[model samples]
Target: MTAILSVSDLTVAYGGVTAIDGVSLSVDDGEIVTVLGANGAGKTTLLLAIMGAVPASRGRIALRGTDVSRSRAHHRLAQGLVLVPEGRQVLVSLTVEENLLLGAHLRRDRQAVRNEIAAIYERFPNLGQRRHTAAATLSGGEQQMVAIGRAMVARPQVLMLDEPSLGLSPLFVSKVFDLIEEMNRSGLTIVLVEQNTGKALSVAHSATVLELGKVAIAGPSEALRNDHRLLEAYLGGAADIADEPSSMRANSQ
Candidate 1:
């Protein structure tokens, strides 16, 4: 199958500093590809550039063979590329249901959008119970669920999530990771940007380790899991990878 998204020689700079440098990667249809790296390693920058929130200094970004290198952010969303940004930026003033509705603004099928909102509620019972509550009143994990629900409302073919597990308790992190896999199994391609390497590798179909804005390692997640040196460098150690027994399988997702 052809790649759903293709990025080549992508670079993003801030003033004179390069946040991302010559990054090249791709996410094939129906696969979860992860970009793993430490702080300031351009993981978020890569996502931003792909979503066209930040202009690339040099490179090509294509979706299903179409060149969208310089497409605007909304244009990318229309093309089935949606970004659930780092901070869960749900509309604080809006009710949970209203926030989900806003995400489907581009869709003309009103019934389908409504159905999707109901489906999201079913998937996240916590959201279902508090659908009428103001978003600001929800807890961190609840807000994260709303963010994911909002993105799903857009019905993106390829969802780029930045730091989905950030700031959540271990329990919430596990829950969120499972939801990500659930989303992927339900036919959404995902490009996960995560600081939590072990959890990311656990659910990713393939993984790429980025160092200082460039890809330091890119391979099947299993290979990376077994390679102590690479695993240690980007993911702490072999013990760390070993700790997540589920991540060592050929297909974690």
Candidate 2:
């Protein structure tokens, strides 16, 4: 499969501290690739670097094989690269529909933009019901929906999500993952930065485990799911891998 987004030797630093250290990875066209790690492992930093929100101290980023290492955040967005940051970051003062409209602000086709808004409402009916409500008044799950919908309005070819499952109820987390799977099935490539290991691996085609700002293990989700030692070392403890599928048990042996 052709890579829709590629990062080679990407590194990000702040003052004397290097947050992302020579990391390299790729997201193939129409695949869901998850970046898994504990907090401060530089998962969020990698996503920000790819979106050009943070300057890379080294390496290259290519979108659909076109080099965009130095591109500005908006430029990357225009190139069909969009990031739904960790905090959901919806404009609290704006109504749900207004916030969604902002995602398509860079587009010149007003009518098409309007249609896209309607389509987003169709995909997320909860947002449609509260279209006129201020984003600040929405619940955490609702705000997350707004964030994802807002990014969708831009019609991105590659969408990068940072800690999308953060602070949501179990039901909402499942809903969010379901939406991601649905979107990927419709041919959208995704780079998912998440700490919710089980759900992340369940939906991901491949997994890359980041440790101390570098890749410690990278492979197909099925293989990684069965690697108990690697999971215990980087992902947490034995309980984390205890829920592995029965098929993974055979592979573990």
Candidate 3:
């Protein structure tokens, strides 16, 4: 398993307030790695730092074994590091298709861009149905799909999503998670920053829990799912109820 993206001893601060503290993690090629934590637990910071959106105070960020800790965000993007930020940052004035096209502006292959758009439409039929409409007119879930679609248009090797399920109905959330799984299955490495522990853990191959900007526990998803102490700390009794099989049931002994 080769690491597509690697973060080592990463740290970031804002006006002297430390956000991420010596954090390290890796996303292997074609793996879905979820980072779960409560609000202000430094989940967003980690993603931003990894994407080079925020400056790292100390650490190294590597993409496919190439050091990119100081690379510009756009440079990092070109290297296949893409971030679909937490909010639906679609352009209100642009048509749905236009906003999506903007996502592929860096690509020199015009035909490929068109083909990718067609593929995106196929993957997200709703967006295809409203390709000409203003992005502002789409519903929250639809807007989120557009955001994710935009990132996909980049054909990223490593896709980092922050709070992707925020403000969606359960059905839409399921759809989003399913799409994520589908993306990973299609050979994209993923770093998912999510608050929805149950669904995230269910879909992730592995996970890391962030506590106060540091790793609390990290291992295979099934192991973390069945660790009673880790579950109780992050999920309360909900973990117990969420576990459907003995394999997923938290082990107290």
Candidate 4:
């Protein structure tokens, strides 16, 4: 199958510092591709650039076969490319249902949008139960659910997630990974940027390791999992990839 999303020689810079350099990767239709790296590894920069949040110094971004390298972020969203950013940037002041409705702000089909929101509530019962609750009052895990649900409300074909597992309890991490796999199984193409190497590799069909603005290692997740040296050098140590949580494995399978 042709790649649903493609990034070629992508580069992003801030004044004299280059965050991402010549990074290229592709996500196939219905595949989960994870990008792994330590802090400042250009992982987030790549995603931001792809989302058109950060201007690319060089490179091309394509959705399906269309070049959208210069498209605005909203334009990309209109093309079914959506990014659920890091930090669970939910509108804190708004109610959970209100925040979800904002995700469909670009849509004119009000009735269909309402139906999609209902569907999201069905998938995430917690959001449904707390629909009228202000997003700020929700716990971290609950807020993360709101973030994912908000992105789902946008109805993206290719979902790029930046650090979905960050700052969450172990239990919430497991829940997030399970939800990710569920979304993938339900036919969403995911490009994940995650710091939890073990969990990321566990659920990813393929993996890419970024170091100092370039791809240090890239291949099938199983192969990358066994490459202890690469993991040690770029991911702190080989032990980082050792703990493959049973929940993650189950979800991936």
* Candidate 3 pairs with clashing backbones: none
Clash pairs for candidate 1? none
lDDT of 2 by residue, 167-223 (tens): 777677778989999999999999998766777888999999888899988999887
| Candidate 3 whole-model C-alpha lDDT, 0 to 1 | 0.85
Residue-level lDDT of model 1, residues 1-253, one tens digit each, is 6799999999999999998999999889999998887667888889999999988989999999899997899999999999999878998999999999988989999999999999988888989999999999998789999999999989898999988877776677788899999989888999998766667877898998888888998999878766767777864453364434331322211
| Candidate 4 residue lDDT tens string, 84-144 | 8888899999999999988898889989988988987887788889899999999878898
Model 4: per-residue Cα lDDT at residue 232: 88
lDDT of each: 0.85, 0.86, 0.85, 0.86
Q: Candidate 1, overall lDDT?
A: 0.85
Question: Worst ten-residue run, lDDT, model 3?
Answer: 244-253
For every model shown, the clashing-pair count is 0, 0, 0, 0
Models 1 onward score TM values of 0.92, 0.93, 0.92, 0.93
lDDT of 4: 0.86
